[model samples]
Structure formats: C-alpha cells, structure tokens
Target: MSYSTLPRIPSGWSQSDSQASTSPVSPEEGVVQSVIKIPSTTYLGVESTVAPTPQFERNTADLTSNERAALLASSSSAVAGSAADAPDQWAWRDVGCEARTLGRLSAPITLAASLQILNILVPGMVLGRLGTDAIAASALAMSVASFSAAAPLIGLLSALDTLCSQAATGSSRPGLPGIYLQRCLLLCIASFIPSVILWWNIHPIFIYLRQDPVIAAMAAHYLRYVTFSLFFTLAFESIKKFFIAQGFHHAISLVQVLGTPITLASVYFLAVHPATSIGYVGIPASVAISYALSSLMAFAWLKTYGGSRGWTGLSWEAFRGWGRMARLAVPGAVMVSSEIVALDLLTVATSYLGPTALAAQAIVSMTIQSSGTLLMGLSAVTANRVGNLLGLAQPHRARNAATAALGCGTIVGIVLGVILYSLRGQWSYIFNPDPEVHAIVKRMIPLLASLLALTVITALSLGILRGQGRPKIGAYMNLASFYLVAAPVGFLTLRYTSMGIVGLWLSFFMAVLTSGLGQLVFLLRTNWYDQVLKCEARLAHDGHHEGLMTPENHPSA
Candidate 1:
C-alpha cells in the first residue's frame, strides 16, 4: 500500500558523475526496499539513475511482500551468495524447463522406460510355450485384465496427481492427506464395478466370440483371478500416482523392480508344480500377488515419507471440497478408458479371423500397450506439472510444461518405434513358437513398426491434452479417430482388400494419428493458458486457496 522515491541523482546519469559526487554509489551496496507480508518478507530494487521498465514496475505492484523479497534476493549484488546460503527455496527457475526442456528430456526417458516395462512381459514368454491357442488365450486375458483394472483407476490417479502436485508447490492448503485417502476409497469403489462386469460377463463374451469351449473356459478362469486382483491393482496405482505427483518416481520404480522377480518366480512355480491345480492360473495369480505386494510397498513408502509430515490426518471433507475434481476426473477416466475399450473392440474383431490372427493381434497390441506405461508416466508427470503451474497462477509456465511433455514423448516414440521394428523377428518368439503365428507376426512386423512410430506421436499428444485438463477433448478426439476413421477404414481394407490382419494394424495406426493430430490442433487453437489463468482467478475469488499455490492477482490481457 506504500510507495517510495529515490535519493537525489542526475536526471541523465553517468558513472563519472557518481565518482565526483559526495555520496558515491558503491558497486556492492544494496539499494532495494524490503516489503513485508505476514510471516514472510520480499525486497525489490530500483535503479537510482534510470526509469523502471513497465513489466518490472507491474511485478512490484502484483507480487506480495514474500514474492518481492524472493525476487530481490534473485537480482541483488549478493544474490548468488544469498541463494547459496539460504535453505532450498522455491523459485520459478527451480521449477526447471517447463516446455521445451522437459520435452527434450522425456524422449530418452520414454525409450528407456519402455524397456523397463517390457521386462514385465517375460511372463508371457512362459505362457507362449503352451501352444498358439493357449498363447492366444493368455494374450486376450491380459488385455481384458489390464483394461478392466486400468480404466477406472487411471482417472482417479490422474486427479490425485493434480492435487498432490499443486499442494507440493506451496498451496498452504490443509487436508492434503485427507483428500488423498478419500480418493483412494473412491477409486477402490469405482474399480469394483468393472471387476464385476468382467467377472460376470466373461462367459457370455466368450460365447459371442465363438471361442472353442476349452479356450473360453480357460479365459473365464483367468478373468476370475484377474477380477480378484483388481482391488490391489487399484490400490497400487493410486499410491504410485500420489508419489509420482510428489516427484517421487524412484520409489514406484523400485517397487516394480522388486516385484518383478517375485512375479517371475510365481509364474514359474505355477506352470511347473504338479501339486498346483491352477495350471495357467499361475499367470493371473502371480499378477494378483504382485499387485498386493506392490501396493503394500507403496503404502509403506507413503507412510514413511508423507505420513511423518503434515499429510497424516484423514478427513472426508476433502472429498466434499471440489466439484471441479470430479468434473476433471470424469473426462480423464473416459479418455483413458476409450483407449482400452478400442483395444478390446479390436480384440473382438480379431477373434473373427481365427486363433492365429487373434494371437498375432494380441502380441502386437500387448507390446504396444506395454509401451503405454512410458507414455502414461511421461503424461502423468506433465499433467501434474501443468496443474501445479496453473494452481500457482502461472498459465504461461503451465502451457510450457505441457509442450515439453509432448516433445519428450515425440523423441521417445520414434526411438521406441525403431527398436520395435528392429526386434520384430525376435519379438515373435516372445509370444509363441507356433510356426503359423510366428510367420504371420514376422510378415506383419514391418507395418507394425511403422505404426509404432506414428502411434507414439499420437499417444504423446494425447498426454499433452490430458495434462492441459482438457480430457474431454482428448476423449472426443479418440472417438472420432478410432470409430469414425480408423475402425471403418481398417475393416473395409481387411475384408475387401488383400491387406488382411496387416490392414487392421494399419487402421490402428491411422486412428491414433487422427486422434493425436486433432488434439494437437485443439491445444493450439484454444487459449488453454487463459483458461487455466481464469480458473485460478475464479478459485481466488471464491476464497478457495486450500490446496493451491500462492495466490496472485489475475493478469489482464
């Protein structure tokens, strides 16, 4: 509320005038005025000899006392010294490269990350030994299981990711821990609906597929086990997202590393042990056990790290606080679910082509799906960063973060595509040993390789849109691409043209490409930055500062 004037100095200042002046300005002397806010103070400096820039003066008027002090500390003569001496403090620069820089980093991160998840597919190697039909059945089971578990959970986790990231960025909001716990409950409850549907409808679905009774029976068994595992699956996912939003990627990765060996061991024991009646049941059983173990690990990590701090108490009121959370989450859920649903529909289409085609489709899709973890991981990080920036009332930074994520995804996608293409021959063996399936897969590899590259681009762009909180836009884009463009295009080519299964794969590529392109266009056309800024402004007006970044006056265009 107060203002100040500078001491007497020449209107048109020169260094030599200062040298002859009775009170010479020392090079190392301080000239900034410190502004005080409750419990925090900030300083701003003015040049005694020159008119201040409009932006600089505006920043002075806009920032609180603490923000001003922080800015002054950044620009002062001893700024570096002060920074080095102070405890690690939050700064815009410390948020790192929001857009371009992050995108560059995400490329290698995506490729290497794909390998880490691909390691999870070694279990399929054991299953592939059970003949082409068995391998086909196994692949179908995994697809169904992953979709059922991931669809409901991804949305809840995405919301958690947004909330936790905002809190970490200094929202000064109480009840973060409470909000996290309640969401965990909501996710668990929501997951049960899908679990029940998969379990109850498995028999009817297999009938629709005209599966041989034996194959149908085996798939149903697998579904039952997978259904049981959904609870743990949801739990593990929620905890992982919670940590990831807090920038704790290593913990989740570590748990996956530890759980992998247990998974392999369980799969081996189930396949070989005569005493065990489950036979192939070991696959889903191993999955179930692994989820339990991983969830427990995540819970322990959360308690040790987050529980010790302010995130201890549980409160249901956190759930009641925001209709916005639910609104954001619903479309997010739909966008992620659409991807899974599209794959399931593809499975249904492939079923009509016989077991060989189904096995081939399963392997290719599963391999592509495994690469999805990398996309999801990078996307999750991007969304969290974007949401946090918006929370802090920094729309430009939020947009930059989203852009960076897409760039990272592009590099990752291309590299992964090349790797998949190069290993096309070897990858067939990972699915099954049947000569027909292997031969068909090898023939299809080239087309699939091309698809992978394009798919990566599409997937990454989807990540960018989701991160921007336009999940509904992404959902619509997917619907248009998959149903209107990709599916119809592929079906016609496969039935009428000689492309066959290969045509189907090509369609998959086209659908994703259309969806990605559309989403990217939306990002460009819509003033998402302004949307984010406006949301921040509305929240401030409503006195909804809880779980948000430090408040700032909304900027006028």
Candidate 2:
C-alpha cells in the first residue's frame, strides 16, 4: 500500500542527480517523487521512532553528519520512481522510528510467551491421567528433545535474526538470499542425525537413570515421534527467525496459535482412547503433530500471504561461506547448549529425590522455561537491533541501544517474575493435583521469580555479544557460568546437603544469576561501540586497498 509521499524540503534538501528529468510521473505510473533532507538535528535522534506517537519516543540524539548525509542521499533513491524503493527511508518521517522498530519487533516475544503459557497446561492435563512417574518421564523426554532440536540450532537461527535485521537497514546484494537459504538447509540437514540418535537412545538412558522401564519405554516411543517432528520444527524455527529479523513475526505467532487447540485435542484423544490409547506416548505424539501442523501452517501462510515464489534458487557458492557463518553460529549454539545441559543436569540431580520430586521439578522447570520466553524474545530483539547498528557502522548507538534493551528486558522480567510467583500454587494443578508437588512448586516459585531479572540481563548480554559477531564470548561465558558455576553448585548441593530437589533448584537459580552478572560485567567492560567502528573502518580499508569488495558488491568487511 502506498502511503502519503514526503514533502519537498526547501532549505536543506539538495537534488544530487546530474540528469534531472523534466516531468514527474502520472498517477497511472504509481510513483511519487519527493526529497526530504534529514537535518543534523534529527540525526542525533535517529535511534528514536520515525514517528513520535509514543510518549517515550525520542529522536536519534546522536547521529553524525556523515550518517545524516548518507541517509539524506538515500532518500533520493526512494523518489526514483518507485514507492517500494527503499521504504526504510520513510521511517525517518516518524522521528520515533527506532523506538517503534523496537516495539514492532516485540510481537514474537509476546507470541512465544503465550505459546509457553499454553504448554504449561500440558503437564496439568497429563497429571490427571498418568501418575507422577509418567509426568517425570515426560519432563525428561522434553529436556532431551529440546536439547537435540532447539539448543543446537539456536546459533544458526539467531544468526538469521541478527543478519536479517542488518540486511533490512542496509542495501541488498547478490547471493544474500542464497546464503540465508543455504544456511537454513544446512542447519536442517545437520540437526537430523543427532535428533534421530537421541530419539532412539533416550529411553535406554532414562532406564539407566532407574526410572520405571515401562515409563522409559513409553517415553522413548513418544520421543521418537518428537524426533521425527523436529525436522519440521527446526525448519519452522529457522524460517521464523529469518522472517522475524526481517520485521515479519506476526505470521509465525498466528500459526502457533492456530495449531494449539488441535494439538490439545490430539493429546486428549490419543491418551484416553480405548483402542489407540498410547499412555505417555500420547503427549509426545500430540506435541509432534502440533509442531508439524504449525510448520505446515507457517509454510502455507508464508507462501499464500507472504511472497509468491520465494527462495526458489540454488547457490552452490554460498555453501562455501557456511564455514564462516557456522563459525559464528557454533559458539552461540555451544553457549545455549551448555545452559540447557546445566538445566538437564539439575534435572538429573532431582532424579535422586524420587518420582514425586522429579515430577515436581519438571513442572517447575517447565513454568520457569515458559516465563523465560520473554527474555528470549528480548534477547532476539537486542541481537537484531545491535547487529543493525553494527552493520550501519554506529557502535556507540549500538551500545546505548543494547543498554536500553537490557533495561527494558530487566523490567519486563521482574514483572513476569512477580506474576509467575503469585501464580505458583495455581501452576501446580497443571501437571498433577498432588499436594506434595504443589507444596514443592510453591516454595520454589519465589526463587524462580527472583532470578527472572537476572536471566533477562544474561540473555540480553548474550544477544548483544552474538549480534556483535562475538559468539565466542557467549560460548566462553556459558562455559564459565554453567560448567564453572552452575554445574558444581548442583552436584555439590545435591550430594552434600538435605536440600534434595530444592537444593538443585537453588543451584539452578544461583547459576543463572551468577552467569547473568558475569555476562553483564563482561558486556559493560567491552568497547563494542568502538569495535563496530573499527570493523567498518577495517572493511573500508580492506576494500580500498585490496580491491576484494566494492561499494556495489556489498556493504560489509
């Protein structure tokens, strides 16, 4: 849809084209031309909204003349006979565009939180039909399945978030789409084998944990279904991240919502049926079907409502660049993988406490994981925004934006903590109505809430570092935090004290808090803003000196 055109600027605006056309286009041509020069005053507030509709909106209060000039020059291209040409420049009209951009990107976070909220009810439903042991097995299955799928691919998907956002703000280039698609395909292929192996072996692992062989066998069957579904899930996750970073998240959320009711029904029918009764297998089956439906739904939605004939080409050359992108993505995956492993290790600690404790811990962990959805969402936003700033060669603003995002994320996390804490008693009804499990969950709620803020800070810092193309920090931080801090705490406390599962939970909280604090300190100490400038400068120097990249080729080092 065409919006109103920008008004011609009289004082500061200058036409840069040498061959000026005499006549403007007709209405039939569907084009409008107008040049609006971005003043030096506006550049400082460039980080603010393009439109200051919100009270918190501020202009970019720190944009330099060079950046302002580049933006102004870019506006001329917007008027070069196509409304679709560089619509990003139109964002300048809002004056609060940056803030609005941040707000716009939050759609996925909210959606993801809502989805997690729905999953919280799963344990509750299962608790009524299956016993505590069954619930425990299911939880363990989820941890394993999630690790195989979500944890390993986080870096790859997250890279899409950062890179896509950067691509949006900058000029497009040849092979960009191919690179993204290749990366996605590669992730899909790589994720399959581990997922399959985990699916096949998870039951035996649980059996070795001394869980009931029956529950383990059933859980393994369910996990196999989940494993099969993971291929679709990972693809959907990759596409979701890619589109979200490109400022399109609403569709993914819609697909998720649309699939939820069906999934719930599937679980209920499969678990309770006379002939098809699969017991715990029903849960995994429902989850797998849900993901598959959602993936298909997401794909269909994108195809019909999104672009026609999207990403239909092959780029063999881009495959060579996978090593570089994977280099960046691996650290992020490792960082995420380590944290998940810590959480799983804590689960292992709770295993010694018996079925009731394990069931209680699983329920509580699910809730906590659900609550952290907002943190993950904010982290994604921070990564994308920071990456854009770095890509545009504005590191100071990137730092400031990262800082602001952290502040915002922290406040959100605190509020979520309060909400989750208040509802602790109520949450126990989801898995099983057992009084003992309820009591345990209620006691742990406060600790989880207290640690919520810290989780946000840690996640945001990870996002910042990852977006800054320093996934190595994320990897190292996770190693230090989980292996160095969280793991030892879990083992020592569980082994040496009578705290039992509570001790493990406490250690979990301590790990996140300590890790978050450490990440924050590291992030603050780093000169990332200066690093951005240096990167841009180095890229420019390399281009000028070595003739490896030209202005028309790419806007990168």
Predicted structure with the largest lDDT when compared to the true one: 2
What is the alpha-carbon lDDT for the whole of candidate 2? 0.59
Model 2 regions lying over 4 Å from their true place: 1-100, 147-150, 174-178, 202-204, 272-277, 308-312, 528-557
lDDT of 2 by residue, 1-557 (tens): 12222222122222222113223323332222322111111222232112222221222122212122222112222112211123243333232333444555566557765765565476346644578767776776777766666567655566665555444333224235335656655865776676687678776678777867866776677677666556665666676665554444566667767777877787778776668767767766676777777777876765676552124356665456566566667777787777877777677667667777888888777766766555676677677777665555444456556666676677777887788778886977766788988888888878887877567777878888867767777788788877777778878887788877777777777777777777787786765423443333322321232211213233221
Measure candidate 1: CA RMSD: 11.4
lDDT of all the models against the reference?
0.58, 0.59
* CA error at residue 555 for candidate 1, angstroms: 25
Query: Could you tell me every candidate's TM-score relative to the true structure?
Result: 0.76, 0.76
As a whole number from 0 to 100, the lDDT of residue 67 in candidate 1 is 18
